[model samples]
Structure formats: structure tokens, C-alpha cells
Target: MPSPSLPPELLLLVVEAVLPPNPYQLLPASHISTRTLLALTRVSRATHAQATRLLRQRCAFVDSSRRLADLLLCMPRLVPGLPPVLSLRHLTALYIAPFGASLDDLPTAVWVRELFCEVCETLRRLVVQMPFGSLDPLDDHLSVRRTLRDGFEQLHRLEEFVCVGEYPALSVPDGHTDVWRLWPELKRLVLFGVPMDSHWLWWDIATLPRLEHVVLARPVRLDAVNIKDEYFHKLPREDVRLSRDIKVVLMDLVYDLGVVRTERWKEIDPEEKMTVEVFEVPLPFYGDETPLELVTEWARRGALDGSVWKLDATKVRQEEGSDG
Candidate 1:
């Protein structure tokens, strides 16, 4: 007699193992094809349920105003809404950005806020690159920032949160970020296409005990610096603490027509336990054909060999104690 067929769950697990690239990345390398998923769903009612669950757990989209609007309208038909409300329960990651131009209105849309609210609990990683040249009014920008903070503050276990593009809502006149308080459990944070000198955020970042990597790219002067947190910023008169897990990547934004290649990348330094990939070319949110110098250029001339700067927190602590 022929052997019995395996369980649908087991088969689906096998399929997952065979195609492990994150669906949210939607990279060409991803092996999760629509045809395969369709076959899996048709295998059996059990397979349909499990496959459907997996399908809705990750979201990837090209950041175009039209696409975003269409996606918001289509999400309901695809993902099961969370209880007592309308939201996706299993979604954990999202990557979306406006291609060439910024749709300032898109960030403030009701659907956008609702979507963020819906994924607040389950979202572990988020990438929204509107990067700069936003046309939204200042009030709209502030509103969007507040909404983001509201949504992000609810996320207790979020690990990676990236917000890039024109005047990141996080920026305010006072030099304090609006979202720093919201990221208690975050491990990696990248703020590109903006000015960094004003908002150091050293205190807020170091406090996150789990934080391991940070990438800051300021566009104003095209300044980039990297530092290991074994010694954090010990400003002369502040109570500086220690967070040994930091590895930073810094770069500048430049509009160089001579620069090309979406694949142009650099992993400047590599130590026993630390590595930082400083992009020679920042990923373009617009389609590849768009020739815009909107990236945070690795503006400086150097090997970027992790010898940028250093801060000694251990000595500062000792000095602070002695100041008494």
C-alpha cells in the first residue's frame, strides 16, 4: 500500500522552510511565489487556513500614493481583522516608501493611522521611507508625527523601527525627538535624510538595553561618524552610563550625478564582533530609473574603517564620582 499523505500543517512548514526570505522584503531572491501559495491553499481546508494565516503575516509594498490608497482599500479583503476592531493581528513587519515624490497627505491619511494602530502590538519591524522633499504643511507633519508617536508608544516589544524621508516628523524646534519615549524595547534605529547634529539622542538610545546597532545620516552638512558604545557620550557635566552593545553607521546626503548603482554598498569595518554596512548608495524609494540625488551620501573621503570618533563613558563615570 502507498504511504499516507502528510498533514497540511507539516507540508506548509516545509514550504516555509524552502522559501524563507521575508515576504515584507518582496526581494527577487524570495522564493515565496504566488503560484505556490495558491497551490498550498487549494490542498485542503487545513492548508488553506494555515497558508492564509502566513500570507497575511507580512506586508510589503511600493510606496506610491496610489498604491498605498489601493492597499488600504484591499487589506480588509485579504487579512482577517483583529477582534473587537478592524486590524491585522498577525502582521509583524512593513516596508513602504513613496517612490520619487513625497505624498505628504498619505502619511496623514486615516487608513495609515489605523493601520499603524492595528499593528502596534505585533509589529516588530517597520520601514517607511518618505525620505525628504515632503510637500505637506508643517501642521500636517506635526500631526503625522504625533500619530506615529501614538501608535509607536503602544508597541511594547517593537525591535526595529525606521522612519526616513524629508523632514522626519520626529524633528521639532527644541531638538528633542517625539518618538524616543515610544521605543523602550527597540534594538535598531535608523534616521536618514535629515539633520542629526541637533538631536543627539545619545541618552535615549543608550538607555535601550537591547539596542545593538544605530545608523544616523544627516543631510545638511553630509557628516558621518561611527562609534562603539563601550564608551558612550560622556559630556563633561552629565551622568553618563554604559551600554556596550552600540555599533554606529553614519553618512551624509548628497546629490551626485556621478554616483550610480542601487547595488553600490560598503561594509567599512569588521571587528571580531562588530560590522556596519555604510551604503555607498542609499536605496532609492523611487523606481530605479529616477535620477535623484536624494540619498544620504557617504559624503566624507575616507576608508570608513570604524575609526571615526570615540567617547569614554567609563572615564566619565569615574570623573563624575570624583567631582563630589
Candidate 2:
């Protein structure tokens, strides 16, 4: 006897019930049949409306060719209709990489707000990787500021933000300050390859209500003394609320881990609740030592508070070793 054929409605219900919210995984279901998959767009106006929501939930954009057109072409079809089918009610995560300044063409502020509204409403994680050239210092500052302001205005639900990029021409005067003031839900932040005084840039970090993990990689030229003095003199002496949820990691591209670890972070924020961890591996080379030590220390410290800090030294080495 053959298995009885189920009704399309029943199949649709089953598929909708089991479809993981991730877009990468959603592709496999397409193999069952285009009709069955597209049926997702018909289950309800809500699901049809949320097709892009499902797509952006787990999107990845890579720009290996260094060409904006090539990178845009490489985007998966799942993201093609993302701008249209997305809903501001159900978005949770977003990863974006724009090469050759393709993002400059779009109205940065408007686009960012639209995208943010769609994702940050229920978002927990955000990862952004764009080439430095995409941002213009004089011409794009206002737009960038507007974009950031609009994007973060309503993102009270965010937990983590990971940004990786070379030195962009754009500037965010007290940008970190604004982020802390606005995103009360933020908990973890990771930055890579930014050319700024990390210590000065992060002076207002003590204000974050729930920030627990911070990772800085390949900071160009950070001054330990300035950082130490600023934290020691400028920061509050004792804020039980502020001290309990802050941890820091600094990685330099041109120093030894042992040397960087000895920097006077304690002088900067002497609150016994705050812990600073520094690791500097030799430039252009990586060993098991740095990652193992960093992870071990992070786990040891974070475990005490039921949190975790992660550093991927191999990935950092690969990125630095590659010739751009």
C-alpha cells in the first residue's frame, strides 16, 4: 500500500510549524518543491509579509571580489526582496557587508532606519562589515550620524553589536556616548580594526547599564597612560550599578601579549567590579598561546558572573595576514 497524499493545507501547516527562522536553513526546504516553498508566502498575510523577516534573520554578506557590483550580485535571492517583505515587528538579527561604497548610493539614514526598525525591534545581535571607503569624512558625516541616530533610536532590545572595518573617513563625535545613552539593553560589544584612541573613545562605557563584555582588536595607537588617567580621574569612584557589569579586552596588532597585558587598566576604572583583560600578539603572526590564554582568562572571570568572553585569535591572524 502507498502512503496517502496529504492536503496542501496540512503540508503547509507542517512546513510552517517546522521551518527554522534562519534563512540559510530555509533554502533546503526549497528543494522539496518551489510550489511548496512559495506556499510559505500564502499561509497568512502575516507570513507572506514576513518572508523577508525570515530571510534577514540569518543573512551573511561577503565581498571577496572587492567590487560593489560583484558583492551585490553575490547576495542570495532570499535577500532580494528583503527591503519589501520585511516587517518591523519580528526582525531579530542582521549581518551586512557593503563593498566599493555601494551603500553610499542609498540614503544612509532612511535605509538604516528602515532596516533597523525591521530588525532591532526584537533584535538581539547585529554584525556589520563594510569597507572603509564606503564612508566619506566630510560628505557623509551628517548622513552617518543620522543613520546611527535613527538606527539606534528604538533599539532598546539589542544585546550585542559586532562591527569590523578599516579606518573609515567618517567620524562619530561622542558616538559611543550616544549609543550607551540610548541602547539600555546592550550587553556585549566587539570592535575590530578601528583607528581611534580606544581609551578615549570608550570613556563613557561606564554608563552602560548592562554591558558586560567588550573586545577591541587591532587598535591602531591607543595610549595606556591617557586611558589609565582618564578612567582613574574622570570616571565615577563608586557606582554599584555601573561597576558590576563591565569587562574589557584589548588586542594590539603590533605588540606582545605579555607587554600589552601589563597596561594600567586598574587605574582607569578602580571599581573592584570592573575587570580589564589585555592580550597583544605579535603582528602578522598568531600562536595558540594568545587565544588559549585569553579564552582561559575570560572563562575564568566570566564564569564567576555567569557570562562569557570570546576571542578568535586565529581569525584575527588570518585577517591581518591577508594582503588587502
Candidate 3:
């Protein structure tokens, strides 16, 4: 007697069960699911198709150089009769995390360019974690910067763009303003900082046709106090009348995980709430968390609007004669 085989749907469900929930993590060890999925692929032809589909859907687990090399190697060359094992066109989301080295290395840069070219049309979300000092305006990094900028321009279908690890508030030459205009479908943008030299970038961001949420995870400028005055004064009222939501997350200067500030612009009109809500954590929290993590937590629980929040740091500080 032969053993019974499982249905394709059930097999795919099993594959999905083992996949990592948060694929954006930087540590390779966190993606133990990668091994499990690879094992499932070897079970049979039916299992290979289902497992490979999930593997190609999100490429966030490729954290190290060796994994990246293997990903590229899996791409099949144009053969007469054989079907492609894995297709880059199937990918919809990608996370690029440059750990310690620059993405400008010869092999790595080539891989980046090729990967971008392959997924340019289909990719809808991108999260980049650049190592600090990687995007500096030095002659050595000019070519790599151009490659990255060009790659950004090619992603017409991109909806969400998140860049962590460092501030993107560079000079006009490397300004994110230039790169953002190309993404017409972009809806959510998460950045560490915003350029304070001028108001044009902020206005430009608001003007985007589909943009709705702008999260400055850790703004060096535009604190809880100054944003109420300094931020809106700069943008042209006529140009920024369009409705949009902007969130500014600031950290306490002295304490590690002290306070989280979120300012939301429900509408362009100044008469609206337009208030900054502060979250005072009474319980001890993890010190290793990033600002983006906190922002995500608030967003997940629908606490971003500050309606249920009790503490208002801006008013409390003002009453105490302390500036935010």
C-alpha cells in the first residue's frame, strides 16, 4: 500500500506556519524558518512550488552576504525546456540591511543593481537599514549612492518606504527629497530625521498624490514644543492645505527609554486638535528597542491618534516652566 499524500493547500499552510512573522529583523538567526522552508522544498515537486512561492514573496531574511549570493545563484538562466526554480519577479517586498560594511563593495553592488532591475516592476514595499556613515557625501561613495538613488526611482509601484539605522537629513545633494518624488504610489514613509534647512521638502512630501502617513521616528529637530510654531510657519499654507498625517517621535535626552511624542495633523486646518500626545511609560521597558519599534507598537494598537492617551507632555512642561 502507498502512503497518502497531503493536498497542496494544506502543504502551503504548513509552509506559512513556519515562516518568520517579522521578516524585517536584521539577525540571520531570527530566520530559522528559512531552513525549514528549504527542507519542505525537497520533499516533492508539489511541495517545492508551494514553499518556493513563500520564499520569494519576501526577501527580508537575506541578512548576510552568503545568503545574498545563494539567492542570486538560485535565479535560473534562460534555458530551452526547464522552468525557472525561483523568479525575482515574484518578489513583492524587500528589506536591505547593510550591517557593518558599505553596500558599495564590487560584488555586493553588482548584486544590488541586478536585484533592483529584476524586481523594479513588482516590488511594492522596501525597508532599508543603512549603516551609519554609509551615505556620507564623499568621493568614494558617489557611485554607490547613484546606484541606490537610481534604484529608488525605478520602483513605481512602491507603497511603503522605511529607512532605519541613521538620519536621512543630509544636504540637498543627497537629499531624500529628490528620491521621493518618483514614488507616486507611496502611502507610508518612515524616516529617522527630516531636513530642517528649508520647508520645501516637507511641502513636497505633503503634495504627493497618495501619501498619507509620514513618521519621523526620531526627529533631531521639531521637538514637541517648537513644532507647534516653527514647523507650520515654514510651510506655505496654500500649498499644504491638503490633508495628511505627520508623526514625530522624540526620545528623552537623559533617560534611555523615557518618553514618546507623537504629533498628528488630522487635517491641514490649524483649528483641529493639532496637539502633541506624550506616552509616559511607568513600567520598565526594554532598552534595546528602536524608535521605529515604539512607533509600530503605537500604530498596531491604534494609539497613534492620542485620544485615549492621558499624558500631554507639551502642556505639562509648559506649566512647570520647562521647555520641551
Candidate 4:
């Protein structure tokens, strides 16, 4: 008996089934040549459909210095028949670099469900590098805040937000506050290199019922004249019943070699005001060798004082030495 000959359509189907899901890895396979790929597309309608879906799903565009804007602008023209990979329901995550082009360049119809915008937001998870300059330029700062707010308003199901830049001021405007209100489902938040005086915003954050974790880094110190305790009074108490349901992690970096002071929260009853515990930890230099150790020691101290706190020493140490 003779063995049956495999049809071209069946051969393509077998190749597609065996190829890696990622195009970068699959391109090196035997049947991945341009002629073979074109033939596979023509042999069966199912093969054609699967190939198109796979190609679009694994697509990635990386532009380091914002020059990719020109190429991105030409995508629709160069591939007029192909649909955008960044449709509203399919987009899960996006990452951009510091000097990348703005999202305003993208068509408004293009929707991203979860985005990591490094320069600015017209995208999600907007992560901006802290600019090295004076914070007095209110207009410039306001423009950026407005852009972020606009982007936030568009994401109906945004669940996580991160900001890596220095906040301009403690007094966030009404428009920005309104955008924050829109994100009721936000679960995790991270703010790095933000102004210390912005602690006032913690009051606003307490209103977020679903928030589980809050991480803050490189907080800027406010002058004595600008210090206000009204927001502090609104801060979540240390009591289990009164405490904020979320965990708060703060890492203070010491730029100057000055002594750091810790705060002690006290509960005032009708009879007397008594100190429950004293929380103290040294502020290490931003890039110091034991920065994580310092934070860990602070957290350990907090835990000893009856505060519900835990620290991932391994993660902190690993991250301390990482470029990120």
C-alpha cells in the first residue's frame, strides 16, 4: 500500500499548529519563508484567517527617540487592509520610553485598555520620568495634569495607575480630582519622586474603597510655612477598625546628611492622650547600598508597634540593585 500525499492546505494547517505563538520565534521555522507563507495564506480560508490573527496579535513597535511617530503615522497607509492591533477590548498592556512621541499622535478611535505611557498620558499607566527643573511653572504643569485627566476619563475599566514624576504641587485642581473620582475600581497605585507635601492627596485616596496597596518614593519636603495638619488628621488611624484597609509603603531618601525624625501617632481619649507606639527609621541616600534594608527595618519596627505591615525583603533588595 502507498502512503497518502499531504495536501498543501493540510501541510499549512500542521505548520501553523506546531509554530510558536510568538511570531518572532516562529519566523525561523522551515515553512515560514515569504513564498511558503503566501502559499499557506492562499491554500485555505481557515489558514488565512488564523495567519492574519496571529500576525496582528504578536505585533510590537518600539521607537526610542519619538522618531517612530512618522512610521506609526504611515501604518494605516502602508497596511490599509490590516486592522489596528490596539482595539479597545484586546489591548492589555502598553509601555513607552521617556523620549517617545506623545499619544495625541495616535487616532482617537484607537483604544488601549492598559497602557504604560512613560512620557505623558493620552494613555494608561502613565509613567513620566521626573523632569529636572523648578516647579514654579504652573501653566506647564497644569497642561500635563489636564492631559492625564483627559486620558483617565476615557478608560472606563482602568484598574491600576502609576505615576513616576514629581508632582508640581499639593493642591491638585478640581479637574484632576474629578478624574481620580472616575477610577473607583483602581486597586494598586505607585507614585515615585513625588513631592512630600502632596500627602494631602492621601485624604482623597482614602475614599477609594478598592485600593489595596499604596507605594510612595522620594517624597519632597515642604517648608514649615506650608505644613498643614488638616490632611494629616484625615489620615487613616492605626486602630484596626479605623485604619485604612490598604497597606501604605513609604521610602524616604535623604539627599542631605541631616538627621531623620519619625512620627508617633497617639489616640486621645476623654481622660488622657497616650502614645501607642513610636515608629522610627533612618532615611538612607537614594542610591545607598542599604536603602532596602533601611525600609525593611522601618517596616519591621512598624509591625512591632502593632501596625499591620509586612515587607518583601527579597524584592526590595533585588529592586535596589536594578536599573528600573
Candidate 5:
């Protein structure tokens, strides 16, 4: 007998305890070490089944293109118009950044985008990072973002979202209704790969009363005026009452920028500057591990409240002290 000869039920509990509690981390092949994975798989059929359930619930693999294709192949028999065999209703977290830098991999990109959209209805935590070198043809870039926007538009259940991609001009045309409803359930949003011209999201993001934690990436752009808005959110004064008490986290700050330049981001709202916190990590990948850990804590648990999340997008906030 093995050690104390524990029962199967107890053994299953032990296995689960050793595993990552986050459902998305249940990937046996990836998250689990080779030896641990083998040991878990060898335990018994029931243990295997449990492991399989975890895999089905969350796919937190770093390389998404290959695994997603494999998953697509496994989804029932080449059906026509049938709802997927794996709708992933129980999925809670996902991490998908580009695996490589190649404009030719547009097909894989499309597939990954589609796959994420399909499961958006239930996912609570999501991270999508676009490769800096991936945007070549303008059409493909715009099209993918549009698809992503549409996908996000319907996600009333998502809690935490991390998007690192080309978000230069998410311009809201004057008469478009129902724009802010895109992220009603969102609590924490971490953005990387922020475009130089991307000032549009600041107003929308800060005003989201439901939002608690916001993180943004500041590329090492030091032309002073050139990177004026990097890792910055300018909350208009008039609409400040409608906003929640949000804490801002700045990841990967470009060190040489100096305190004088950094303080200028607060000109929009100096008091709002108090809400900001900076995490000093060496950039390029922000060490990769830290971001995921932060995301996990952010996405792990949060009670959603309908009343506090109320937003009246119709009444736009004109910039305070503006000459216009």
C-alpha cells in the first residue's frame, strides 16, 4: 500500500489542493510540471477525469495558436452549424499574447480572436497581448480590432480584462449609442501595447464606477511631448462625482523620465495622482511572471454590484478649464 493508504476521495482532494486554485490554471500539460503531471495522470481514472475537467474548464497556455487549433480539431466531428462540443462555460481565466512576430500568421490570429469571442460570454479573467511587429496590412489590423471590439461589446460577464494591443484611436463618433456598456462587469483592466495617440480610452476607463484597479504600460518613449499620455489617465473634473474611487497601477515605468515629467500627468487632476501606484520592474516583458500573478489576484474574486456600476454615457464630460 502507498504510505497511509488514503482513499480515492481524499487523494482527489490532495491533488486538487496541490494544483492552482484558479480554474484557468488547471491545464495539466502546461501549468503542471512534467513529473507532477505524470504523477497526477497515473493516479487513477477518476483523478484523470478530474484533471481532464480542469483542462476543459480553463486553457491558460502561453502559446495559444497551436493549442487552440488542437482544441478546434477535438471539437466533435466536423459538424456544420452545430454549437461547439466545448463551449467552456466554466472557464474563468485566459492568457493569450502573440506567440511570434509575423504578419503572415494572420489566419492563426483570426482563429484565436474568434475562439476568444466564442467563449466571452462566461470568461471572468482575460489577457490578450498583440505582438508589436504583427501589424502590417492595415486592413487585417483594423479588422481584428473591430472583431475584438464587437466581441467585447457583448461581454456583460467579464470581470478582469488585460489587453496589450494597438489601441490608438478607439474614437467614439458623436451619435453612437451604447458604447460604454462594453465592459459592465469589468473590475480590473490592465493594458499594454498602448498606442502613442491613445487618449480616447482614458475618459471611458476612469469613469467606469465599477472599475477598481487599472494598469497601463508606458513604452520607453521619452520625447517628452511625444509620450505625453503614456501610462496616464486624465479624469475630467466635472464628472468626477460619477467616478468610483479607483487605484491606478503603473507597471514598467521608463525610469529616466524623471519626477518633473511624471508629475505633469497629474495636471488633469492632481488629487487623482494620489490614486496612482508604480511597480518598478525591468521592462520588455515586465518579467512575464509578475503580470500574471497580479492579474490572478485582480481576477480572483470580486462581488459585482449593479447600482455602483451605473453609467450615463449620454452626458459627456467636457474638459475642465478648456478654452473650447
Candidate 6:
């Protein structure tokens, strides 16, 4: 009599048992243990398939320079009629950490373009935290620039896109137009800490046919007066062409007081057939939560289905010493 074999479905569940609760959160590479995944992949061909998929999904969290370099150096190992290694082909969502050690020596542009090329057909959500000085590598090489642009154009299926940094990710040196038109299927776009000159992004926003929500955000501080000007001035009332209503959300995070203070306004452009709504929400909490974490969570929730507006009731103030 032959020994009984465990079903593949059961094997997948066993493999998933080792995954962290929130695998997508940015965590230190050392904190993540892959010994189990490696052991399982060596167990059998069936286990290898399942473990490979899990590992590929893990690449979505590009948290450190080492992790980014690993991804850049990864090569695909395809099994007959099966998914390849480095799991780029199976990826659907990605998040780039907002803060980390400077990754200057790596070919950041090639890595980004390679990932984009493989996942362009499948990726639905992307959150890029492009910190100051991060964009220099991408703009340094001419061939790299063109290839990156081509890869960007191929992401037609992406639904939610977020860019957060001191400078706009899409800023062009020569002032190119209609760049936003590339993502015909984009539904939600979130931009934070955008520079003063990125007002051109508004023109791109108007070109997205399926765009329903646009979020512009900044941290609340003494210089927020200038921040307000930079964000508000981007909202143009003219030449807006849309068949249905779209909402533009402006948010400001007050980190010191553990509050998110927001103001919403509604602008009805009759000639342009677009309705822009600015929603005001003030949410306070007590914890070690960071501004980037809070904003990323807010943007992702709203991007999924626009249910972020339901947090309106949480706008009420909670007293400092109260235990309620």
C-alpha cells in the first residue's frame, strides 16, 4: 500500500501559516524569517509552487535598500507551464516605503522598470513614497529615462496610484502634457507633499476619463499657509471635461496633536460638468502612529471603494484625559 498524499489545497494553507499578520506593512528585512518558506520549497514540487507564490507576493513591500537590490538582481526561473521565480508575474499590489537608507549605488531605474514591465498587465494598486533625492537616479540616464517612460505607459490596468514625496513623481523638465492619459483605467490618485510647481498635474488629472477621486495632502505646520496655497491653486475651474462627477479631497495631518484636520469645499463647475468636493475631517487618536502610516491607510481605504468618507463620525473631539 502507498502512503497517502496531502492535497495541494491543504499544503497551501500550511504554508500560509508562517506569513506575518500584515505582510504588506513595511518591516525590516531582518525581522522577516524565510527559513520556513525555503524549507517548504525543498520538500516537494507541489510545496515549491505554493512557496514561490508566497515569496513573490512578499516582494511588494520594498522596505530597504538591501531588499530593493535583491529585487533588482532577481532572475526569473520558470518551471514548465508554471509561475516563475521572483514572482513578478503574479504581483498585483506594491508599496514602496517612504523613508529608509539612501539607495544611491543601485540601478533604481532598471529595477523599477523591470518590475513594471513584468507586472504591467496585472498590477492594480501602487504606493510609491519617493523621498527627496530619490528621483535623481531615475533622471540620470537617457536610455533609462525612455525605458521607464515606456514602462509607465504600459500600466493601463492600474486602478489606484499614490505618489508621496517632497517633489512630484511625474514632474517633467520640458513640460510634457497628457501624461496622465496613459492610465485610462485609474480611479483614485493620491499625491502628498507635492512641490509648488506641480500645478501642471491638474491638467493631467482632467485627462483621466475614469478618474473619480483625487487626493492632495500635506502636513499641518506653521508653513502650512504656503502648503494650502500650493494645493488649492492646483484646483482649476476651467477646461475640466468629464461626463460624471469627480471628487477632489484635500487633507492635512496635524501630527503633534495626534489629529488629522481636514477642510472640504464643493466647487460646481457648470460649464465643465465636474463637481469637486473638499471634505473636512478632524480625527484624533493617541498612539505611536506616524503621519505616513496614517495617510497611506486613509488613501488605500478610500481607493478601494470610497468608504473612507464613513469616518465622518469620528471627527468629534476626544478629550485629552478622557477614557471614553
Highest-scoring model, lDDT = 6
The candidate scoring highest on TM-score is 3
Candidate 3 per-residue lDDT, tens place, 139-257, comes to: 54546666655556678888877665455333336555657667889876665555433466555555576775555434544433344444455456554434445443332222433
Model 6 C-alpha lDDT versus the unseen true structure: 0.55
Residue 49, model 1: Cα distance from true site in angstroms? 3.0
Position 305, candidate 4: lDDT = 26
Tell me the lDDT of candidate 5.
0.48
Question: How well is each residue in 84-186 modelled by candidate 5, as lDDT tens digits?
Answer: 3333444556655545664346556566656656666767776655453455335454455444445456566778765554322322333233333366777
lDDT of 1 by residue, 14-127 (tens): 657534453334321134454465466566655665555555453344356566566566556542332222234556766555344544453544455666666677778766
Model 2 ranges with Cα > 4 A deviation: 2-56, 60-89, 107-109, 132-134, 141-149, 152-154, 167-181, 193-200, 226-229, 252-272, 278-309, 312-324
Ten-residue region with minimum lDDT total, candidate 1: 311-320
lDDT of each: 0.47, 0.48, 0.53, 0.38, 0.48, 0.55
Residues forming the 10-long window of minimal summed lDDT in candidate 5: 303-312
TM value for model 2: 0.56
Stretches off by above 4 angstroms in model 5 are: 1-5, 20-30, 33-45, 56-59, 62-64, 75-89, 136-154, 164-181, 193-199, 219-243, 257-274, 282-324
List residue ranges in candidate 1 displaced over 4 A. 1-10, 17-35, 60-87, 98-100, 106-108, 131-133, 136-149, 164-167, 171-176, 218-231, 234-241, 251-279, 282-324
190-239 in candidate 6: lDDT tens per residue? 77654324455554665676887676665333233222233334545343
Question: Mind giving the per-residue lDDT tens digits that candidate 4 earns over 46-125?
Answer: 46555544432322222242323432443343223443333322422222232323323122212221122221222223
lDDT per residue for candidate 2 within 87-156, as digits (tens), equals: 4345465444443454454444455555566555577765555554555545663465546455666678
Q: lDDT value for candidate 2? A: 0.48
Task: Please give the lDDT score at residue 280 for candidate 2.
Answer: 47
Question: How much is 221 displaced in model 5, in angstroms?
Answer: 7.4
